[model samples]
Target: MPGYHSFTANIIYNLAQLGIPIRDSEFFDIQTYLEIVEIHKNVYAGETPSRQATQADIDTFLG
Candidate 1:
């Protein structure tokens, strides 16, 4: 399968769509935010308060 393109490491692909830049640093703590979406991927199938997924995300960023 070789007909499309790819991306780099775990980095946010669609910053505009995600509306990440709009989040205030005082609220979402953007300073400590480390988006892990496989580089070109911008789809994280989960919610923020979802313990199952958010916990892992927190662990990854805080750890």
Candidate 2:
């Protein structure tokens, strides 16, 4: 789960850049962090949960 941990860290870093306060411990577990990430990805893609995100959508969100 190291990769997931790294992903979570990146998300935390990005949120910090946006002036959002999020503690690493708040994620609780990898599943929780992943779910949050998915939700954010969907929002960034301007899609509903039922919609799949394209690579471009993911790239834009990552950037």
Count of backbone clashes for each model? Answer: 1, 0
Could you say which candidate leads in TM-score?
2
RMSD of 1: 14.2
Tens-digit per-residue lDDT, 1-63, candidate 1: 343333211123444444555434235433344442233243454434445667778899899
Model 1 gets an lDDT of 0.43
- Model 2 stretches astray by more than 4 angstroms: 1-9, 14-20, 47-63
Candidate 1 is scored at a TM of 0.20
TM-scores, one per candidate: 0.20, 0.40
Put down candidate 2 lDDT per residue, 1-63, tens digits, no spaces.
769999767977756754546765464666765676677666677854466889998999999
Cα RMSD for candidates in order: 14.2, 10.0
